[model samples]
Target: MNMITMGIEEPWFKDPGVADMFGGKADVETIEGTNIVIRIDDEILDLVELTVARFHDDGEWVWDTPDAYGWTRNINGAKEAAMKHGWSEALLRLREVVPSEVVSVLDNIARMAAAAVRN
Candidate 1:
């Protein structure tokens, strides 16, 4: 299983209010920048990775699971599947701890990454 751990070096994380929002959920390193770590399961991670790789390679966007074997061409559908799998309970917890604007920023970042993989 792979663990997704991200270090947020954004200046906004230094704010006391912002740090407080995370409470005990995230590890606030210091006033310089805070590191927020969100862990997710391997299946979702693998799906996202595969989706991005296919998108970058301009290959068919189909999730070829272990139990399935077929070349089904569905770029939009694949992208949607990738996006849906990318979302998790950790994101919901992140939303609860961070401001709406911060959440929006994170969401946008996630979407951008997912878009890059999808395209």
Candidate 2:
């Protein structure tokens, strides 16, 4: 099914209060422009939480380093560690806390990334 179809029916998608929890606060045009919501059934909120943590950890690594190589290596290492250290658990916990509908809205991000790759 299409991203909208999958997400619209989810519990998180309907609630306005929890919209921002899954990165749903962004404008419709931006969200639609990226088409990030490809897999509506996917755990988008969980992924988003993981992404935030990824950036936070990677940023810290970069801040700690001095050279360009440090930027790349540390960022890469942080990502590797994040994924290795239980990305699944992070996402699962995010899902447990955030609403399912918000998660659906967040899944659209995958579509956006896919579109970027194809281009």
Best lDDT among the predictions, by candidate number: 1
lDDT of 2 by residue, 49-78 (tens): 112111233233311101111222443454
Give per-residue CA lDDT, model 1, range 1-119, as digits (tens).
Answer: 22344332232223224344333332233212222234343222222121211222334433322222222356455434444443443355545544654566788899999999999
For candidate 1, what is the lDDT?
Answer: 0.37
lDDT of model 1, residue 66: 21
Candidate 1 ranges with C-alpha deviation above 4 Å: 1-50, 53-60, 63-72, 89-119
- TM-score for candidate 2, residues paired by index: 0.23
Q: What is the lDDT of residue 10 in candidate 1?
A: 35
* Model 2 poorest 10 in a row by lDDT: 62-71
Q: In model 1, which range of ten residues has the least summed lDDT?
A: 44-53
